[model samples]
Target: MNIIEDLRARDLINQMTDDEGLENHLNESRVTLYCGFDPTADSLHIGHLLPILMLKRFQEAGHRPIALVGGGTGLIGDPSGRNEERQLNEENVVQEWVKNIEDQLSRFIDFTDDQKGAKVVNNYDWLSKMSIIDLLRDVGKHFSVNYMLAKDSVESRIENGISYTEFTYMLLQSLDFLRLNQEEDVSLQIGGSDQWGNITAGLELIRRTSQEGEEVKAYGLTVPLITKADGSKFGKTAGGAIWLDEKKTSPYEFYQFWVNADDRDVVKFLKSFTFLPLEEIDELAKEVEERPEQRVAQRRLAEEMTKMVHGEEALNQAQRITHALFNGDIKELTKEEVEVGFKDVPTFELEESEKGLIDLLVEANISSSKRQAREDISNGAIYINDERQQDLKYFIDENDRIDDAFTIIRRGKKKYFLIKHV
Candidate 1:
C-alpha cells in the first residue's frame, strides 16, 4: 500500500489539507515532512508517541522525516490545547530537556546517512538569530492581528488573557516551517490534532512568503490526540507522567501501561503505535472479541511496543518479572529485578534489630497500626517470601532472606514490602 493508504488504514490521519494532492506529492518522489516537538519536559511521554510513530511510518514509506526540537518556541510556549499559561522554563533547563528528548527520539528513527533516514533539527538555530525588526518586517507582516486573534488558541484565552509572547507563538512556528521549506525543501508538517491551527498557519506562511505564483505548495497533517476510553488522560499513572527515560519510568511500568489499555482503545492504539500490517491488526481485533480472557492481543501489543521503545532485553525482563509476580513466585527475582519491578510499590526500611515479622509489617506501612499487624498475622493473612506466616511471634532473620540481603514481606494477599540488610 502507498504511504497515505497505509496511514488511512491505520487511522493515523486525523486531519490533513488536500489528501489527494498530498498523496500525489508522496507518490511522485521523496517528499520531505517535518514535525516539531517542544521541550516541555525532560523526556517525551506517551502523548508524543503518535507523531513519532507517524514520522517512522513516513520514513519507512520512503519519505524524509525531520524531527524538529522546539528549543526556540519552547521559550514561548504554544497555547494550543493548554488550559493555562505555561510556567516558563529557564534557557539552560530547556536546552537540557532538548538534548534529552533528542537522545530519546534517536532510538525510534534511523539517523544514519542512508536514504529516507530521519534527521534532527533545532529551530533555535534560525529563530534565535533573527532581530525583532527583521522578524516583524519579514514574517510577522504576513500574519495579521485579526487572523491571529480568530484562532481557537487565542480565542479560548481571551477572557482570562493571553500574553503577547504567546500570541506571537504561531508566527514563530510558521517561521520554522518557512525556514525548513526554503533550506530543506520540506513541504509537509505533521503534528497532533491540537496543533492543527499552528500547522495550517505554517502552510499559509509558506504560500504567502514565497515568490508570486510559486508552486511551492505545502501541506499539514495531524494525528488524533490519544485519550482513554474512560474519559481520562493517557500515559499518566498515580505516580505522574510515564517518562520515556528508563530512570524516570522503568521498563516494567512502561509495559504495564500498554497492558492496561482499555479494550476499546486497544485496536486504535495498535493501529497508531504499531507497525503491524493492517490485516494482522484486524485479525488481532477478531481474537480480542473471541477470547479476551487469553489477552493474546494485549500481550502482543505490549510486547511489540515495549520492545520498540525500551529494547529487547528490557522487554524480556519486564515479561519475566510480570509472570513471576503474577504467580507469586518471588524466588526467581534478582536484586535488579526487585528494584525495577516494585519501584512504584510503597517501601520502608527496618533495622536488623527490628526485624520481627509483626514489627516489620507495621513499620513498612503495610498495616496502619500494630494492632492490625498482629490481627493480620494471627489470621494467616501475612506472608514472607510468598509462604504463609501465621505465627505472630515469628521474627525475620537471615534464614528468611532471599539472597542473604533482603526479605519479601507480604501483608494480606496483595500488598508487598521489601526488608533489606543495611
Candidate 2:
C-alpha cells in the first residue's frame, strides 16, 4: 500500500487540504514535505512523537522530509492550541531549546545525503534577516485582517484578547511555507490537528504569492490529536509528560508507559505508533479481544516504542529491569538497573556502614515502630533483596547492598523500600 493508504489505515490523517491531489502529487514524484516544531521546552515529549514519525514514514517511502525547527516563530508562540497568550522566552533560551530539539529530531530522520535523506532547517535564518517593511509589504499584505480573524486560532483567542505578536503568528508560519516552497521545492505541510489553521494559512500565502495562472501544488495535512479511552489526556501521567529524552524519562519509565496502555486504547496505539504491519497489528488486536489478560499487545507496543525511541540496548535494559521487578528477583539487577526500576519507591539513606534490621526498618519508616519491625520480621513479612529474612537479629551490611550502593527492602508482598548506602 501507498504511504497515504497506510496513514489512513492507522487513522493518522485528521484533515487533508486536497485528498486526491495530494495522493496524485505523491505518486508523481519524490515529494518534499515538512512539519514544523516550535521548541517551547528543553526536550520533545511523547506528544510530538506522531509528527516526527510521520516524517520518518515519508522518508522511508522515498520522499524528502524537512524537519523545521521554529527558532523564529518560537519567539512569538503559535496560539493555535492555547487558550491564552504564551509567555515569550529569552532569545538565548529559545536558541538552546532549538538546538536540543534539533538534536532530538536528527535521531529520527536520516540526514545522510541519500536520495530521500531528510533536512533540518531553522526559520530563524531567514526570518531574522527580513526587515519589518519587507514582512509587511511582501508577506503580510497577502493576509487580510478579516481572513486572519476568521481563522479558528485567532477567533478562539479573540475573547481572551491575543496580542498583536501572537495574532501575526499565522503570517510568520505562512512565510515559512512560502520560503521553503521557493527554496526547497516543498509541496506539503503536516502537523497535529491543532495546526490545521496554520498549515492552511501557509497554503493560502503560497497561492496568493504565486504568479498568475501558476498551479500551486502546496497542500496541508494534519494527524489526529491522540485521545485516551478513559478520556484522560494522552502523553501525561501523575509524574508529568513522558519525555523523549532518556535523561528526562528513563527508558524503563517510558517502556512502562506503553506497557500500561489500556486494553481499549492499546490496539489504537499500536496502529498509530508502531510501524508493525497491519496484518500483524490485526493479529495483536485479536489477542486484545481474546486474551487481554496476557497483555500481548501492550507488551509489543512497549517493545516497539521503547526500541524506536531508545536504542536496542536501552530497550533491553528496560525489559531487564521490568523482568527483575516482576519476578521478585531484585538481586539480579545492577545498581543502575535498580535505580531505574525502583526510582519512584520510598527511599532512605543510611549514614552508617551497617544497621540492625529492626532499627533500619523503623528508621526508614518501612515499619511504624521497633515493635512492628520485630513483629513483621517474626511473621515472615520482611525480605532483603527478595530473600525472606526472619532473623530478628539480622543486620543490613555491605553484603545486603546491591553493588555496595542499594539495598531493596520489601516490607510485605509488594511494598518495597530502597535503602541507600551513603
Candidate 3:
C-alpha cells in the first residue's frame, strides 16, 4: 500500500492539502519530506511522537525523510497551541536541547547514507546566517500584513497579545521549506493538526518562488491530536508530560504509563503508536472486546512502545519490576532497579539506631500510632521486601536492605514505603 493509504487505514491523517496531488508526487518520483521539531525543552515529550513516527513510516516506504531540528526557529516559539507569549530560552539552552533532541531522533529513522535514508538538518544553518535586513528584504516581502493576520495562529492570539518574534514564526518556517526544497528537492511537510497554517504558508512560498506559472511540487499533511476517552489530554499524568528521555522519566516509569492505558483509549493508541499491521491491530481490538479484564491490548501496546523508545534491555527490566510488584517478588531486583522502580513512592530515611519495626512504622507515618502498628503486625498485614514480618520487636538490619541501598515496607495490601540508607 502507498504511504497515504497506510496512514489512512490507521486513521492518522487529520488534514492534507490536495490528497491526489501528494499521492501522485509520491508515485511519480522519490519525494523528500520533512517534519520540524522545535527544541523547546531538554527532551521531546509524548506529544512529539506522531510526527517522529510518521517520518519513519515514509522512510520505510522508500522515501527520503528530513528530520528538521529547529535550532533557529526555536528561538521564536511556535504559537500554534499557546494562548499567550512564550518565554524564549537562551541560545545556549536551546542549543543544548537541540543536541539532545537530535540524538533521540537519530534512533527512530535510518540515517545510513543512501537515497531513502534519513538526514538530520538544522534550520539554524541558514536562518542564523541571515541578517535582519536579509530577513526583512527577502522573506518579509512575500508575506503581507493581511495574510499574516488571517492565519489562525495569529488571529486567535491577537486579543491576548503576541510578540513580533512569535508572529514571524510562520515566515521563518516557510523559509525553511523553501531552502530545503531548493537544496534537498523536498516536496512534503508533515506535523500535528495545529501546524496546518504554517505548512500551507510554506507551500505557497515554494509556489510563488518557482517562476510565475510553475506548479509548487510540495504538499503538507497533519495527524490528529491524540485525545483521551475520558476527555483528558493524552500523555499526561499526576507528574507531567511523559518525556521521551530516560533520565527525565525512567524506562520503568515510561513502560508503566502505557501499561496503564485506559480501556477505552487503548485501541486508538495501538493504531496511532505502533507499526503493527492493520490486521494485527484489528485482532488486538477484538482481544480488547473479548477479554477486557486480561488487558491483553494494553500489554501489547506497552511492549511495542517501550521497545521502540527504550530498547529491549530496558523493557526487560521494566517488565521484571512489573511482574515482581504484582507477585510480591521484588527481592530479585537490584538496588539501582529498585530506585528507578519506586522513585516516586513515599520514602523515609532509616536511622542506624532506630531500626525497631514498631518504631519505624510510627516514624514513617505508616501507622496512626503505636497501637495501630501492633495491630497491623498481629493481623499479618505488614511485609518487608515481600516477606511477612510479624514480630513487633523485629529489628531492621543491613540484611533487609536490598543490595545495602533501600528497603520496601508494605502496609496493608497496596501502600508501600521506601526506607533509604545513608
Candidate 4:
C-alpha cells in the first residue's frame, strides 16, 4: 500500500489539507516532507514518536523526510496547546537542546543514502540571520491582523492574554514553510493535532509569497492526539514522561510501560506506534481476544518499542530482569540489573559487615519488631537472596550478599527488599 493508505489504516491522518491532492503529489514523484520538533527539553519523549515514525514511513516509501529542529521557534515557544505563556529559555540552553533532539532524530531516520536520505535542519540558521526590519517588511506584511486573530491558537489565548512574542509565533513557523518550500523543494508539513493552526498558517504563507500565477505545492497533515482506553494521558506514568533517552528512563521501565498496556488499548497502540505488518497486528488482536491472560500483544508491543529505541542488548537486559523478578531468582541478576529491576523496592544499608538475621529484619523495618522477626524466621516467611532461612540464629554474612554488594530479602511470595552492603 501507499504511504497515505498505510497512514489511513493506522488512523493516523487526523487532518489533511487536501487529501486527494496530497496523495497524488506523493505518488507523482519523490516529494520532500518536513516535520518540525521544537526542543523544549534536553531529550525527546515517547509523545514525539508518532511524527518521527511518520517521517520514517515516508522515507521508506521512497521520499525525502526533513526533521526540522526549531532552534529559533523553541526559544519563543509555540503557544499551540498551552493555557499560559511558556518561559523563554536562554539561547545557549535552547541550542544545546536543539543538538540533543537532532542526535535523537538521527537514530530513527537513515541519512546515508545519497539519493533519498533524510535531512535534519535547524530553523535558527535562517531566522537568526534575518533582521527585525526585514522580518516585518518582507514576511510580516503578508499576514493580516484579522487572519492571525482568526486562528484557534491566537483566539483561544485572547481571554488569557497572549504576549506579542507568542502571538507572532505563527508567522515565524509560516516563514519556515516558505523558506523550505523555496529552497529545499519541501511540499508537505506534518505535526500533531495541536499543530494544525501552525501547519496551515505555513501553507498560507507559502501560497501568498509565491509568484502571482504560481501553483503552490505545500500541504499540511496532522496525526491524532493519542488517548488511552482508560482516559488517562498517554506517555505519562506516576514517575513522569517516558523519555527516549535511556538515562532519563531506563529500558526496563520503558519496556514495562508498553507491556502493561490495557487490553483495550494494546491493539490500537500496535497500529499507531509499531511498524508491524497489519496482518500480523490483526493476528495479535485475535490473540488478545482469545487469550487475554497471555498478554501476547502487550509483550510484542513492548519488545518492538524497547528494541527500536534502546537496541537489542537493552531489550534483552530488560527481559532478563523481568524474567528474574517474575521467578524470584534474584541471584541470577547482575548488580546493574538489580538496580534497574528493583529500583523502587525498599532498601536498607548495613553499616557493619555482618548482623544476626533476626536483628537485621527488625532494624531494616522488614519485620515490625524483634519478636515478629523471630516469628517470621520460624514460620519460614523470611528469605535472603531468594533462599528461605528459617534459622533464628542465622547471620547475614558475606555469602548472603549477591556480588558482595547487595542482599535481596523477601517477606513472602511477592514483597521484595534490597539490602546494601556498605
- The C-alpha local distance difference test score for the whole of candidate 1 amounts to 0.87
**What TM-score, over all chains together, does every model reach?**
0.96, 0.97, 0.97, 0.96
Q: Go through the candidates in order and give each one's C-alpha lDDT.
A: 0.87, 0.94, 0.91, 0.93
* Weakest lDDT window of 10 consecutive positions for candidate 4: 110-119
lDDT of 3 by residue, 1-422 (tens): 89888999989999999989988888887789999999999999989999999999988898899999999999989999899888889999999999999999998988877755679989988999999898888788888889989999999999999899999999999999999999898999999999999999998888877987776788999999999988978889889989999999899889999989988999899999999998998898998899989999999999999999999999999999999899988888888899998888899997684398998899999888999999999999899998998998898888898888889999888889999987
lDDT of 2 by residue, 1-422 (tens): 89999999999999998899999999889999999999999999999999999999999998999999999999999999889999999999999999999999988888877645678999999999999999999988888899999999999999979999999999899999999999999999999999998899999999998999988999999999999999999999999999999999999999999999999999999999889999999999999999999999999999999999998999999999999888877888999999998889999999899899999999899999999999999999999999999999999998998988999999788899999999
Q: Tell me the lDDT of candidate 2.
A: 0.94
Comparison by lDDT, 1 against 3, better one: 3
Those runs of model 1 whose alpha carbons end farther than 4 Å from true positions after fitting are: 114-117, 368-371
**Model 4 lDDT per residue over 227-334, tens place:** 998988999999999999998999999999999999999999999999999999999999999999999999999999999999999999999998887776779889
- Deviation in angstroms for 10 in model 1? 1.1
Model 3 C-alpha lDDT versus the unseen true structure: 0.91
Report residue 420 deviation for candidate 2 (angstroms): 0.9
lDDT of 1 by residue, 105-178 (tens): 89988887854466999998888898999999998899889988888888898889989989899999999999
List the candidate 2 regions with Cα displacement exceeding 4 Å: 114-116
Model 3: CA > 4 A from native: 114-116, 351-354
Q: Which residue pairs collide, candidate 2?
A: none
Against the true structure, candidate 1 reaches a TM-score of: 0.96
